[model samples]
Target: MRLTRPFRRLGPAERRIWDAYPTGAWVDLRTGDKDTDDPVNGPAWGPDRTVRAEVIAALLLGAREPEPGRTAGLRLAGARVTGELNLSDAVLTGKLHLLNCHLSEVVSLTDATTSGVRFRGCEMERIRAARCTVNGLLELDGSTVRNGVRLDNAHVTGQFRLSRARLHAPGERFRASESWLEDARRPFTAAEMKERGLGQDQWAVWAGGLTVDGGAFLRDLRVTGGLRLIGAKFHGGIYLQRSVITATGSHAVQADFMEAGAVEFSAGFTAKGTIRMRSARVNGVLSFSEATLEAPGRTLHLSHAQVEELIWLPTSVKGGVNLGYSRIGVLFDGPASYPDEVRLNGLTYEALRGRWTVAERLSWVCRDSDGYRPQPYEQLAAWFRRIGHEPDARRVLLAKQRRRRGTLRPTGRFWGRLLDLVVGYGYRPWLAGLWVVVLLAAGTAVFAAVPPAQIDPDEVRSFQPFVYTLDLLVPVSVFEQRGAWEPVDWTQWLAWTLVASGWILATALIAGAARVLRPSAGS
Candidate 1:
């Protein structure tokens, strides 16, 4: 009978020799037994020769050891491997690397690590580890470290430093959520220090949930994406001086529900994003001296929060510092008000314009306070005397005197009645003069209307024409009524003449007194 192709190709002994070792190793079984088992313990191969997948798997999985004193370079990419593979204390001088190695099946590198396991310039598609651990410093400094650098629910019992590392993928995320960086207590010496960019061109360190209880040091780091510190707690001061944050999210450095001792951003810190301190309680001062915020849409919103101490903005703040509805314990008085809250000494309206409202408000308050001062009344009286507004000034003085004497009552009704009489008669001096003139004219007319006694008229009827006219003007019945002729009872005429003279004198006195006492225009 003719054998089948695969069965006839390999005999029974050859099949038994092939089944002796693991499935992905490449070695000749007929060469030697010791050589077949230790096939990777050999010299290096050139770049043209293909490295068998079985040998590469055995070497990486620690099932076979590479030869000493000879440097070997192997690239196991796109190879399907199963079960746990450990590559601890392996020395590959010329780049022992893995690219798109499908290890979706069960794979563990627990306590199996390398010195410079550089995935520096390659892309790690997806790596899922259950409880895998690394025991050395894994340096991926200048690499496109991508896609969930997550060691979720795992333990890293060594120093894990990824300084100056970049995240390439769009939503590149990292979460060492519950794990701790234990060896972070060791101080970073000068040689171990990482250089910082002066915000020229660099990406920020993006880590989803980073917890360093032993105090992580990120002195002058830069970030191009959002840093979410959601439900994180730190016991150290987060020094972010001279750091540039260009996060696209709401908050550049969000510590939503965090408890920190102190957060200091002293020297030349800048944020091109909104720093939200919503529902966060800071025990100390949130000082931002010499710091600049250049947010595009809405610059630096600190709306609803409670600051226990002071929120200082002392340095040159470029954008609008909005403390619109925030509550401050003590706001220091601005430069204008030095001593008293009421008095604004040396206040100038021209100096303060469009800068601060406090200056203008204080100036207005000072002017109002000085306007009601009692000294203005005296000063106005003196000014009126100097500037020829004396009449108005005297009126003001009289009004002020009346206002001052408003509470005092008059001593007697006699004085009150005298004042009323004086005021009523004082303004009418011409009326008194006219009354005297009328009384004199009436007396003269009455004397001419009545004639002298008739017996005297017959005895001295001398014809002086002026005297005869005077006699004719007088009436004949005047002497008969009086029973006398020579004097004709001149007492009644003398009494009328005396009353008119007295009234004329009184009118002259009244007019003189009114002219002297009245307020002059230049008073």
Candidate 2:
């Protein structure tokens, strides 16, 4: 049960708002320059511009009921609100707009249900609206909150706008009573603090599990601490264009497991710490075009997420980016936009939307800092093959083999190098045929110049040097002249070389043919 407020006890500003509430009129209490007289810390305003928070709360809660058949609302501009506006668990049918007002204490709207709520250009310490429900737009556009805004588990039926808002979060402090040292019977050190999860609670927007029916417009917003949206759901997408977020934790924008239609972190967006979106799903495009991310370690973490289209054209990145295990429908990227270190293991995409050459695209695959990963190469090759660029697909597969060769032992590497020189790991099968022709011609020329003595002088027909040479070079004796002929001196050594070369060439040809026949054999 709440206390009633009589009209007789209302101050000049409160009485004016009470009378105008029945008509839903705009009560502008601004006198001169509002900037010169900052309502948060300036000299006390006269009665005309000062309203007690209790009177406004009473009107909003129906303790001081308006006339029947009239739509009652509270709309004030440039007023100084004294005391805390505690509207916890209240149901308000009217729309509330407090434009350019200065709220002195914490505005607690915990578990309240309202038609709409707008605090545009208002200055407040903080807002505690945990579990609140808004039917229409819940906007804090252009407002400055010194502490932060907490809307954890809240639901909004309409758009949630916070464009151009400034949020300076109150950083985490040491709670000595809850220290792990007392529990563990040890001294508290930095290592202990890290192991025990003793850290600061500096979050600009703690909206975990928040559900928005419409879009979340956070464009041009500035946050001094982390923006956490863990498990939040946005139907109409999230726009973070031109926003600046800086924080001291592991992630500046921690949005793990969140789901949205689309997410635009583009158009001059800057984050001073990691922007982690682990396991998040977006049904539409997730863009980072022309954005900047600067962190000490991993800059953009998109592991295990699923997105329709991923537009990755960041202006700059100070740290690494991880896209491991993510599935994308289409990926649009630029050659020079990638960071020095990247993680692309288990990443899959249906189509690559770019005009870059195969070499440039392969460079993107080479940026993986965790040595060689075969999946990225295979995925690139598959995409190229789908688009009828068969040669480019072979090039990607050839590079994959070359990268894999680096990790082999000396004996394996020797065999790999021989295969590469002879057949290009079967990606260039024509090289093997060309080598066979060259070696055949060289062998033909060597034996034709110096004739070999006949091993069985009286047994066979005349010694044909070309047929004898062919028999020496072929792994199987198809010509039947090698047994009848014998070579001496340097020609004898050449005959032995031809036999060994024949076996190597035959083995290489068979291996190359097998690989070409089944392209996914070794892969």
Candidate 3:
């Protein structure tokens, strides 16, 4: 509400106003009038009084302590401050609205506590608000900050609106270089530099480590350079609904270990670099529904995060979505292409959004290249069971069994592949029936071609080749046909093969039935 000591008797700030446009008049905060005389805005054609930055700040801080609704805060519009505007460590009880003001130097609100601050339609060089606390909304709507905007360690009680705000922080763009291992080559992956914490924060708009109690509304934000929000935490939902961040380096939105309720990177979010949200925890839905990411590999990495609600990643993803060891409630949907490379090693999603076949779901689960990871499969099966999709759950278990078999030793692999090839790990019961029919037909042909000596001559009235073949296949019962014939020479081999086929078919049918009825043990 009041300027403490040094800022109390602040000198007058200076600015020269031009007479070209309607807003081109020198506005003096001291006399509270527009002056058209001191001359420094332009050349001889300029007619404007010069104003100091401190003069503006001192006048805005008020001659006395600001009252509630009377003169609580500063509301200065279209006033150009020629020097650096320093409001650091100041306390303001009311909102500060600086509209359409142009400052030549950076504005420092470091460690300042204010109710709210709106720099709507203003253009400043830069902003340094480290450790500043805003009780209400901080609106940077339609403003242009040429240099970096640092809000590190700041806390906002209400929403932080950066909609239509143009923040410029030059990032290191990729250049065509010959060296592969050198630092001046292509983009350095965020994985390589995240440990050192040099990711996109050096020369960009860094709000890293800030905590917003309310939601962050950042729609249509165009950061020309890199934007880093590493370690930022939001208590309520954060909506970056439509923002285009084009960082040159590997890490564009370096929001590692962030904690938020619900986050929406939906609608028209195009990022050129990697949007790393690794080790972050989301309490609600983390939606990247309509984003266009140009990730080369694991660019959309959200590894080790715990998402309590749904996570939707539809539309465009040009790289891998690494969700290794993350716990998610439900996966609403995801990208189609490169699904096999999606890092879902230890993902735990309860239920999916859409109704997908068991095969489709298993196919996605099998995308991990580590052969057979039991936890993912078990998690999926448990989720399916919880949702009353028992049959699909069995299919998932069967898929896991087959995959596990594939990863086993030589003998186990052989049997696993054989079972998979024959009956889809005992999930497709009809395949076993088809194999039975095939073996029956094959046996019938061989038996009718080469007739054997009749072991039971009186049973000739029921000597049907097809019936005899089927009777040999069903191990549970027998007909008066197996002992009726004895094959000779090459036909003996055919009979033995038919017997083996019958055993395989019967075993497959029983195994399939058991698998369908029983729940998967591992998960």
Candidate 4:
């Protein structure tokens, strides 16, 4: 095929080629337009108004190459353009890309792909597409999107790389609910790559360092292999509710520094593979309420990360959500914020059956000015009761009371003295009584041995037996007649009898008292 005239526009010859070839075989030509000036415009310019609509349509239907340097816009809807659609540097102000380009084989856009199909550096006001499919990789590194990029249900068989791309407006939503990426390869090598789990020949999403100013949402994306977002920053919240990632691959999502209002990984979804979020900071709550992580050694390492709100792992979840050293602020209240403030009610550790330690260094930065307020003792006691640790809780309460007593009114000097006495000489009372009894008995015995001072022998002899008897019978008479009656002779028997009787009575009284007061072994 040769061009008769200077190929300034698409003609009937090119139109026939487009109509003859399959949709996948239509190769897009580079039009050498800078995308920096206007983000949405494609590189190529279509034919003029003089060309018939039917002819222009035919030219773009499935043609390998459009007329070189055309000045008209191309509209190919459902053309089933096959093979590699090389729109490397084409400029199209209108919607240059269509819904779906039917591909019997693979496709390639070494560095760029767009709804308006721009190449190099071109600017377009708007780019819109509902559903598209590329059999091969879609590479658009260093590209810029202006208003909005919409790719709702696009299917790409190979790896998707949009690293270092800037989205001024809200970026496209890759809601590839039913799309699949089969037999894909990693865009970046293993060493330079910060992400993992790229299958040997499986689909992958590589968007490392891609910045979205107005935020991006991946609502229900189902990636067959790994989805890498190493160092990607999202300004708005990212929701991954009810999404499933299979076990054949390693990582399901690898987004670090994922700062936003909130990030959810709930709704009973299972990640048989690992989910790595090392050093990822979540400004708001990071919820994994009922999600299950099936991988045994898989970890969600957020060490040294800061969370303004809670990092909730409610008791309903099955797998352990390790928050080893991460600092989390207030916890969740309900489905939203409850208690008019962030509470720790929804925060749980049901899955943490084994041993774990909370980081001592990092303190939670609470939003309330009063600072990190720990739960009240009563609340903790109730919680312990519910968990069957009430005794422990009661012990803590008693310990607190003792501490208060020690602090408020300490013991005085008098108490100190009493304590000393009790510890030292308290047992002396019983010993002192025993010694007194022994001394009394010894004095009695000594008196009994010494015969009463012998009354004068002459006086005794003078006293007649009758007089002596009368005197003894009446003690008053003996005192009165001390001069008249002769002094009775001091008899050893009488003295001994009196001393022994007196000692016996005193000993009996002492023994009775001792028996009554002293503690017995059996008692």
Candidate with maximal lDDT? 2
List the candidate numbers ranked by lDDT, top first.
2, 3, 4, 1
Best by TM-score: 2
Candidate 4 Cα RMSD (Å)? 23.6
lDDT of 2 by residue, 222-259 (tens): 98777889999999999999999876355679899999
Kindly report which residue pairs in candidate 1 clash with one another.
24-54, 25-54, 204-223, 450-475, 451-475
Question: Candidate 2 local accuracy as lDDT?
Answer: 0.84
* 3 or 4, greater by lDDT: 3
TM agreement with the true structure for every prediction = 0.32, 0.92, 0.75, 0.38
**Error at 248, model 1, angstroms:** 3.4
**How accurate locally, in lDDT, is each candidate?**
0.37, 0.84, 0.69, 0.38
Model 4 / residue 490 / CA error / Å: 49
> Which residue pairs collide in model 3, if any?
13-51, 13-52, 14-50, 14-51, 14-52, 15-50, 15-51
lDDT of 4 by residue, 1-523 (tens): 7534323555543453344333333333323343421323222233311123233333333223443454223433222232344333332222233321222222332333333342222222222332343344343334433333333334333434333333322211221223212211123466423233223222244445544433344433343444455565555555665555543333556666555556677665445445666667776667766665543333344444566665344323222234444555644423221112222222322211212212110112122123332232233334445568655444333232222333333463343233222221121234334533554454344434442333454554332433333333332454333334332245434434434544443444444344324432000
lDDT of 3 by residue, 457-499 (tens): 7664545778777877777438756776777789888777777
Against the true structure, candidate 3 reaches a TM-score of 0.75
